[model samples]
Target: MLLSKASLEAACGRKTIRAAVPSLVSPFQLTVRSLPKQQTERRLVPMRRSKAVSVQNNFSILALDDDPIMISTLQAYFQRSGYHVDIENDPYRAIERIRKTHYDILLLDFLMTPICGDQVVEEIRKFNKELFIILLTGHKSMAPPIRTIRELDIQGYYEKSDRFDQLELLVESCAKSIRQMRTIHSYQNGLSAIVDALPAVYQLQSLEQLGGTLLETAAGLLHASSGYLFLKQSDETPAMHPQKDPELFCTFECTITKEQARAQYTATVFPDQKTIVQQNKMSAPLFDTRHSMIGMLHLVLPHAPQYEQVQLLDIFSRQAVVAVHNIQLHGLVRSKNNELTQVLGKLRDSYVDIVSVVRLMVDARDIYTRGHSDRVSKFSRRIAETMKLDRETCERVSLGGLFHDIGKIGVPDYILLKPDKLTFEEYNVIKRHPDEGADILAATSFFRDIVEIVRQHHERVDGKGYPRGLTGDKIFVEAKIITVADCFDAMVSDRQYRKGLGVSAAVHQLQQGRGTQFMPEAVDAFLSLLDKEHGKEVLSLYDTLPSTI
Candidate 1:
């Protein structure tokens, strides 16, 4: 189980691990620990102790700085790595401490009080000759720190103004130096994690968490105070996140961020003590599919130095390239996945709509014809199988049967759902369904093939049919198949106001009209299959059959 900050702090008897730490390592350094079972007061009051926390450990650090925020940030970053962090805020106090105590690492702030920064470092080396001294400066000045390094044997130095990503690298480098471990690229894993969680567009809370998580992990490797991430929008609005703006989706919530801490960093911003804080846009990205190097991540330092440029930002730039590639890949996958999901949903809806509309039309007719299209569609598909039509063709034929009477949408309602037969006017109106359906369908682009089947279902094999008296050879083969199935189902169905025509009579009617109404070849094919086991199975599926009586 992970310990809460309150519990850990209470157990340690300190507000933070740094102040509680002692210079020398021992169990006596346990300023606080497993608490009393029951205290007179649950709240532990803060105490100023003479001893340091984690002094019994192998390493000791003397972090010297005037800015408490900067000291706190570094202390916390190192504390998580299981190292002792001791702060020396006053420059006078820092030099005195270095003279008296034994320290493994010396962290000195470049800008401080009471004495000059370089003077403190010079004095510290005077007493503790072998300390692994590191200058934690708050500026981008090369001359002061570099001159010292060139002159003396300074173990390591970190720029406070470096992006947290850089700080993390420095920390890792320092840790690895002391521990004698190999250095690894901090970016490979960060880029991979971000890539895995992509398409860049995520829910607000999730995105914020991702930002912090990636930066923190990256910082752990870079040894920086924090990291920052920003994306450029395709378009911009002046009043950003104006009113509950969804555009302000990305955020900064990490304790480790590019927020201004009280640390004096050696920034390469200005020659004097003046700090420059320019907010540059992360737009016009250089990232793309084949090669990705996006907009710059300005590693803004509080003060300017003569020798800071592309080399200083190189590590971040390389990592940024990976981030761009992973993010773009995520975007592509998400877009395609969303598109496919939508398409599949539409196809499903079309299937439902087709079945419903056809059923509605059939219901508009008599009860006996209620399941006509449904059953015939099923049987026509089975017939298509024996005809050896490909699966796609078979499926289309089945769908066409369901919509064969779509032209009936144009048929007068009185004549369509009517229980009685047609008068002269009703017959003419009924005959118009094929043309009406064809016209209705011609308006849409994709349904032209379906429209052909609808237009010809009424046309008979003989020259006596209504719509286009186009006899045998004039009809399409698939339409000829539907015409046969249409007659088979219609004859077998009992009219609303008539006794049902038994299955035998229905089949006998078709056999008699073999060459007259249906294509003889089509009728022969359907009957041959109907005489077999599967045909009987198809017939048995319905309560009544169109038997050739």
Candidate 2:
């Protein structure tokens, strides 16, 4: 049904209106000189105002109406209401405004010139996809047809019968909307600033420097009194041996200890700023590079009242952990590159360099057993010396122990440290150690003897062992000697799961397993050597282990 002018005005009640720009434009200043009133003087008069207002820099409202009085009234209303409202008596000018500057809200005259309000609305939409438009007309019939509003996503339609009252409310309502939008914008800006400043400070290399960054930036953003960052390093020196570095920390906990953190660092690293002012949870924020689980960061207030916001502190703590992890990954790449570069350099050395390099690797694997391969090699030489083996044979025996379990490099840390029983699959994996050891030895020159020893280390007297199990004399004497030493070490050294038996108990177990698990002669020789040197005195040699460690 066709609608009349009064019907449209009747439908236009007092509903709220608001202005929101999808994008904001920054404003620049233009100082203009005032021009003189008389042409005779041709003097300049001070320009009182520019086309746009300072506060309205980010927003612009375009108003179009054919009636000069009505258009002038609406313009005056918006200008006083803090809007940079552009006026267009010609509906075509409204179309031009959209093409030129960005406008947030469009106020169009339903009774405008050359183009009617409805036609103007349609054209404005084509060029200004985001401009929100409202229709204004004195004749209620001039208001948009219901079909247009429902389909066009238009803001609203206003009737002009009560021009002064309706236009004032329309202008004020859009202003309130702009104010609320500004509120949300300010909040978003603050949030972005805080997050952006974080990575800048967290990248500090030294703990003290990182701590300072955490404290300063955190206090500035979170309104924290002070805070600290904590971090930890993961040890990767093979699973048979475990090592840990002192955890790094960034905290505000006035008094905190490593023992205390070890007990409770997993819980809330960010204490509620609300509760922090109320009680201490003994927790702190933790983070590090390498993408590793760095320790926590703690934000502390000397007095709880000193901090009004701890939630921000918590957010920072969580972000720091994520940052630390990335740093650790970067460090790992660098370390691996260095290791590969070193390996490439070593590739140029001689055949004897292979044996020298293997000895160096064993010594370098862990501080606790830095000289272990060397010591075991010496022992193998003495035993061979006693047997009056050939010079080359004796040398092979000594070097064999040096590379005996070198295949261990293939074992993953978790599996190597398995503290409990293994499935058949896991045991099968463990069985590959001998072959792996052999492969490592065979990779370089002058290692054929050592390779043979590694490959045959698990082969037994009864032909029940792996990788071509050889019975009796089929296994090399040197290989048999390594089997004895390997078993002795396994039996006497503590593992991830179990404590080793003392030397005497281990010797007894060997005696029992002889001919079944070991050769009887090797067992006899092992026991005779321990009998000469007190087993108790050998255990005492490790007393130099760091007393404070």
Candidate 3:
């Protein structure tokens, strides 16, 4: 027979016993005699007060049983032991409640009407495998099979009895195990977060981006509510100098107000201060490879971090220091690159000035050819533009035209300035000017793009031209455009040898040479440019030049 609630309370004092009333039994009969002497003595021994407090704060338990008496007894007994206990008589409702709320341990009855204890365990196990479960049975024989217990991962089994000493002992054991497991899991998660944060920290190129990511990652690792990063910078002093004060680079906050974060920031001394782990607050110095402090990270955590959490924080701080160093190096490299680019631009302008002087010297040797290269340059650029060529190709063609006859500087004055038509030998000497021009310009990297254009401008589309007779597609498109421009300008401009051919005559010559002596595309593009207002203005420049030397 089961003892009445009044009798059970009187016998156990403040500690309640988890016992069940058998069906068809008289509730009035006291069953205190059924408890063994060993069990009775064990119940008299006091449990550790600190352990009970820890359990009450850190763990919660849910008691699920069909019998109201069984549920009430289990709740009273566990609650008296300083555990957060919730009781439910309906198994379905208990499963639903467990789904919504996280309970650390489950005190489940073995026998129920619709679903057995193993069935309930199966349902719970499908979604939650981490819950620590202890099954309570009316008798040893009524307990679930060992296979069912092992398969379902049920932690322990307790048979219902007059005394609750054994059940209490089992729960205490499980609680200790749970606390250890929780610690291990927390450490695992912290380590995983550190690993995940490393790549992002290292890959960021700018200080602002690195700072933001570092602060966020550090805050997340410690579960901090707010944080700020202070990066070291000095305008007149080295960053690692002992006298330099750290600068506040950036700040990040979550669930903390800016004013409060600012006040905390103001209160803390940086760079010189070592790592601090105080109640709800932590700050660590970031150091580079040289062991010099580069920055400081301060965080406002939710609680005092444990020793392991502080260790994790240290690991993360070391990694963040490397990230800070890398970003600083990247900034330095970018600054140097920009400086180099400016220097290169000045040098390039100097080279162009030198080339202009050389072109002037070439023109001075023959009065009739004065401004001849300039006209060809403008004409080539216009033709290139009309052909829908890219800007870079157009610029190359224009420069190539200006320098195409540069090798005339190498030609003998008597042969170059001759008033009559050149003999075959002199004509061959003129063809060599293209190769000589290419050789002269090839000495500078700046003019490399136009070297081929200068060399191949005289190449015929039919593979019948000089200085490496490259045909049609083999010749550079830029050179082909320059060929057409050079031919038109040479024919239309007056020379020491002959009067200038009119624009109509030059066009007729270009039409006659198309596809055989010149690229058809280049001829068509040049003719098209001649129809435009800009091209007509260019043509007018040649009209003002001397008709004869």
Candidate 4:
């Protein structure tokens, strides 16, 4: 049915009256400002006025009516009722204006020439589902079906009448609903930002570093003024190792007394579950995937968080547990590695004692050299120290002296025990001892550095000595020190064939042999060691030979 001008005004209950328009032009397709003067001295009911005024001032209302006189009247009436209102006479142009402006309530006319209010609301819903809408009609017959109202998602409906009290009530009701939706959107945005930032905080490796960043970020995101992060202490004592224990930390905007913080800590259960407890203050427990408690966070905010926010904090707490566990694993691996290294050192020391016992058994075969190996070992160590050699080289030189004659165990008893002069074949058998000793020591990994010293101790600077006959620099520095110490001990010690050369004669022989048979530096160091305070004590200690077996 075609609607007339009178019929449209009858729907709105207004005449063809014009009010003075505002001088400014709005950027939207249609803009209706409040009239210069109010048209109705009538006020909303006292009960409605009190309720409407509370939220009416914050909302904006837009009306879509084809009658110009009806649009002007609504502009004046709604504005006087403490709402920001705009009106559109062209229903087609109203869509564009609504799209361009921000309105809390859209009051759409039910009857129009080309388009109805329900169709316009359906069109508006395509672009904006959040807009609160109300349908205005002249009669119930003109309104769409109940299904159509539900489909369009309209908030309320009002019949155009002289009172306009119902229309005012509709506008105020829609405003309250709009406020709730906006609050929900704000919370969703805040939650999305927290989820996005959590991965970066989880990337921290250090427990202290992760704890500090995590608590500060959680407190700020939760709108908390103060927070305490309490991680459980491990059973192990921190003083036994270098690493310190992880402590309870707090991130706060205000000062909290130590007594109060201690009280809060004591109140938390020993093993807390993933739950939030609220009484005078708010507390939440952090748990891992297994639901084991790792820590707890205490917060002080102006307002308490919703259930959804507590769920988010629980998620962050789980991530914190994983990070802490990773740090603990790293520390455990390092401690185990250090303990393994110390145990290996003790094992090596025990092996050295076994090698000394073997050397003593070989010396027993030749009673004249009962303490020969021990004396040579002491002399080699002292000479190495005087030369300022590194400790490892000195130790190898000393150990090599103990094992130098181990190959004599392989020689036949007849040749080794003969007091008479040896034949050329027997002397050649003696010269093979150095080579055999090196071969025996080479089989063991612990004697790697000592291998060269044992092999070349018979080598001479003049290249006239035995085994490989290695010359001057070809022999290792450690081998040279052992060579000088061995020669000095062998010369001064008694032999099975003749009496021993005394200290004076042995010193003179070493001096003459320097740079020819012995390394000049090694000889000089050995001679200097003999002049020290302990030289006489060391010589007297090995002066006697143990009785032959």
Candidate number of the best TM-score: 3
| Runs in model 4 lying further than 4 Å from the true structure | 1-223, 230-291, 301-316, 330-346, 385-452, 462-474, 497-512, 528-542, 546-549
Pairwise TM-score winner, candidates 2 and 3: 3
lDDT of 2 by residue, 214-233 (tens): 65666566444555555555
Global local distance difference test of model 4: 0.70
Which residue runs does candidate 3 get wrong by more than 4 Å? 1-55, 65-73, 89-93, 111-115, 137-143, 159-166, 184-213, 234-246, 249-275, 364-370, 382-394, 407-436, 439-445, 473-477, 489-508, 520-548
RMSD of candidate 1 to true structure, Å? 22.3
For candidate 4, lDDT tens digit of each residue in 1-549?
Answer: 235523543444322211111111111111222121122223323333444333347778888888665566677677777788889866778888878888888887878868888889999998888778878765545657767877888776665544565566566556666666666765676578667766766573566676677778777767777777776544332312345654545556647654565566667673346546474345767655555555677777777666656666766666666666656666677678888878877776676666666678788878888888888888889888989989888888888887888778778889988889999999999899888888777765787778878888899989999888889789898888888989888887777787778778988999999999999999998888667686787678564765431
TM-score of each: 0.38, 0.38, 0.73, 0.50
Q: Which candidate is the best by lDDT?
A: 3
Give Cα-based local distance difference scores for all models: 0.54, 0.59, 0.76, 0.70
Q: What's the TM for model 3?
A: 0.73
Candidate 3 lDDT tens digits, 1-549: 123322432344232223221221111222333443235334433432222433355778999987676676667677767789999977898899989999989988877757877889899999999888888876545667777877898877766665566677767667887888888988899999999988898995556677789899988888888878776652323333234434545676645554554565556665444577778777887666666565668888778878778777778888887776666666666667888989988988788788778889999888888898988888888888888889999899889999998987889998999989999999989889988988888877889999988999889888998878889799999888888888888887778788878889999999999999998988998888777665668667766676552
Segments of candidate 2 deviating more than 4 angstroms: 1-59, 127-130, 185-467, 470-549
The predicted structure with the larger TM-score, 1 or 3, is 3
